[model samples]
Target: MSARDAPRPRVHVVHAHSEADSFVTAMKNVIVAEFRDTGHQVTVSDLHAKNFNPVASPRDFLERSDASRLVYPLEQRHGYATGTLAADIHEEIEPVLAADLLVFTFPVYWFGAPAILKGWFDRVLLSGVCYGGKRVYGRGGLAGKRAFSAFSLGAKEGMFGADGIHGELVTGMMRHLFQGTMGYVGLDVVQPFGGYNVPYIAQDKREGLLDELRAVVRNLDDRPVLAVPDLDDFSEKLLPLHENPAVS
Candidate 1:
């Protein structure tokens, strides 16, 4: 390829659910095809289909040197797994480091990411490379890239809103995980694209979601930074105070 043809932006689509026929997986396929159709250099990491090792084993932990201990507990376990994952994990991280944008696709289980995707984060986002020490500012390793989720939630939409049992927007609940983890590592989180009530959603609504997802992908090149708040200054700048009952 010529130099002009060689520098296209790379996109990595990480799919975390298990079943091929599952709604989340199907949604991922839709996303991959859309990204490809746009002519971006795309890569896929199908975590469940690839049988990714979700647990950090004892040997994995022991592989760490003393200096690595100060890093995230998960970071110390790199290159410790045997059999297939010895290669799989390495392959997963390659595209991650190379990609200009990453789209995480998964089903929200128990109000959070599926265990496997979380494990991917635990394993792939490490200290020195992704975060820690004097690098608390955006100067950390992951500063320039972008990361965000396009998730399907199984719960009813109303249950995730204010005054409901869950009492928070799903994204707000997850701000710390992405903002603290990926954000710490330097990925600006683009606004997430989500669909709620998956099991009960109608065929038409599902199609509409797909259309919206494609729109998001089509506009990916233009996404804004969407920078997160600093943790120390977070409560002061963002938190809301309680109103007195006697005020009115």
Candidate 2:
């Protein structure tokens, strides 16, 4: 069905950028505005502005499973089950849990996402709530959801690729995010939108990128999706269930 004829999505944007006036923020704003204009419900978590605590520590759990020792993942299970996660983490998780589409906005630093955004993956994707034991990949809690990323970087697009100076961006440089984190937890990962050479490029070129980004967001659901693991073809020991089993 066409986007106009389809049901509106619940979009949750996690914006990670230090400067208030940065291009990262602009991309985040544009993505959010486009979704809202299309009658989608949009929720934003501006990490820097909110002073989100990115560090994962014992303090995250208001009531630990083992008060004597701190096991972060174990405690995550406990916290989520008991509704004892820290106020800030819980607040951000609400929108994430409610979202049909999760849009991550940040600038690539050191060929990776900023530390704050990385920390979001660590802290918010609770072991029990999102994934645990056999509940991962295609069987994960968020199996039906989708994730999209819109990031700005200083380098040109040519600098990345299989043989480029920086290698691949989505499946290569940030494979951990695309596959391990997002896809691992069962979100169908979308091929990301990159604002390449923004800092060194001309204003006209930057505007062109923004226009491209807006179109991406407007036609967000139609974007290409990356393949992730499908557990139905795997045994409990993670072996192929069939000789012809496909590995995504």
Candidate 3:
């Protein structure tokens, strides 16, 4: 089938903004609209609006394996196998499992994802289902999917670079999210689209930023993909080809 005629992706957007009318939230709306307009199916999980719990604790499991003490990963494993994960976690995972594309929308908080979004990762990306052991990076359980980030920052774009004052926004400040978490889980990472100086930018510029994001969602397939380790370059046991080169 022609590229245009091919089926569009099923998109799952995890939005982290708290304000309903904020520009960051507007960017999320644009993503939903563009995907839907292009014949894609879109689902959204508005973290703050849903009052999603960002804390991961014994409460995450409906029934703990050990009532006396909580071993998080073990409980997560038990939870997935026993269908005991909390209701909200299951609800969020459903869309993540069904989606072809995952979009993260948020305002940068302390050069990282908002606490809630980080909690989503902690609670939703189930250990057994999304990853474990050798199932990480290229071999991760979520390998077939793609992930994109649309974020806004209070600082200017130029301040972020390998040598810039902030020193590498995506690869540095936010690396924990895009790389450590998303890439570690095997999603094909896309170059991020950031709205810089968001708090200080004028109204027209904010609108233009939305327009840029609109085009980004519309042409998501054309966006550059970021680099991550491929299992092919490693051994069957996740070690490097040269005597298990992967850093232990």
Candidate 4:
């Protein structure tokens, strides 16, 4: 079907920031607005506002597979199979299942997502449901869905390059967030929107960043997705048969 004749895409934004006035929040708002203007259905999971629990413990499962031994992944696999996962987890999963596009907006904490957002990945992206066994990489449960990350860093752009103190923002995040989390679950990961030195930048520059973010959101469907290795390229033990090129 032609793009115009297709159904409106369902977009879910998981906004992880304590302060509503933060630059990250503004970036999220820009995304939501742009998507809405383009006729996409949008849903925002405001983690902090909803007081989401970031810690993953026994509370996530209603009935554990083993009463004494608590192996989280096994329990997740069992809970998802049995439909006995916690109410909160089920609540979060609904929006994720309905989404055609998922966007995460947060401020980088120690070169990674904030703890709350990390917890969302831990608790909501369940094993049997989102992935398990052969359901990973390109063959993952959520394959064909698209995802993007919009985040800000405390360090300047220069500090994230090859020879800088932080060393390559995209490369570092590829290991932790993009390839590890989103791509692991089969989402077609899009290039991230990184706002560097957000806290230290001037007012005009920050506003310019917001404008750039709006443009990114508006053109999301046209953007090139990051290339991930197909499952067929791996062996039975899941080792790559050929050398994988660096993401940089």
Strongest candidate by lDDT: 3
Give the local distance difference test score of model 1: 0.71
Q: Write the per-residue lDDT of candidate 3 for residues 61-143, one digit (tens) a residue.
A: 88888999888888988998998999898899999999999999999888888899989999998887888988999888899
Could you give me the TM-score of model 4 versus the true structure? 0.92
Write the residue-wise lDDT of candidate 2 on 1-248 in tens digits. Answer: 98678876799999999897889998888888888887888899999989988899999988877999888999998898899999998998889999998999999888788999999989999998888888888888888999999999988899899889989988888888788899889898988999998999988888899899998877777888998778877878677778745633
C-alpha RMSD by candidate, in order: 6.7, 3.3, 2.5, 3.7
Q: Better model by TM-score, 1 or 2?
A: 2
In model 3, which regions exceed 4 Å deviation?
1-8, 235-248
Residue pairs with clashing backbones, model 3: 161-168, 240-244, 240-245
How high a TM-score does candidate 3 get?
Answer: 0.92
- Model 1's C-alpha root-mean-square deviation from the true structure amounts to 6.7
Clashes of each: 3, 0, 3, 1
What is the per-residue lDDT of model 4 for residues 55-132, given as tens digits with 9 covering 90 to 100? 899988899989898999899989878889988888898899999999999999977999999999999998877888
Each model's lDDT: 0.71, 0.88, 0.89, 0.88
After TM-score superposition, the amount by which residue 38's alpha carbon in candidate 3 deviates from its true location, in angstroms, is: 0.4
Using TM-score as the yardstick, the better of models 1 and 3 is 3
Per-residue lDDT of model 1, residues 65-160, tens digit only: 444343434334343332222455567777888998888999887667889988888777655566655454366667788886789987777886
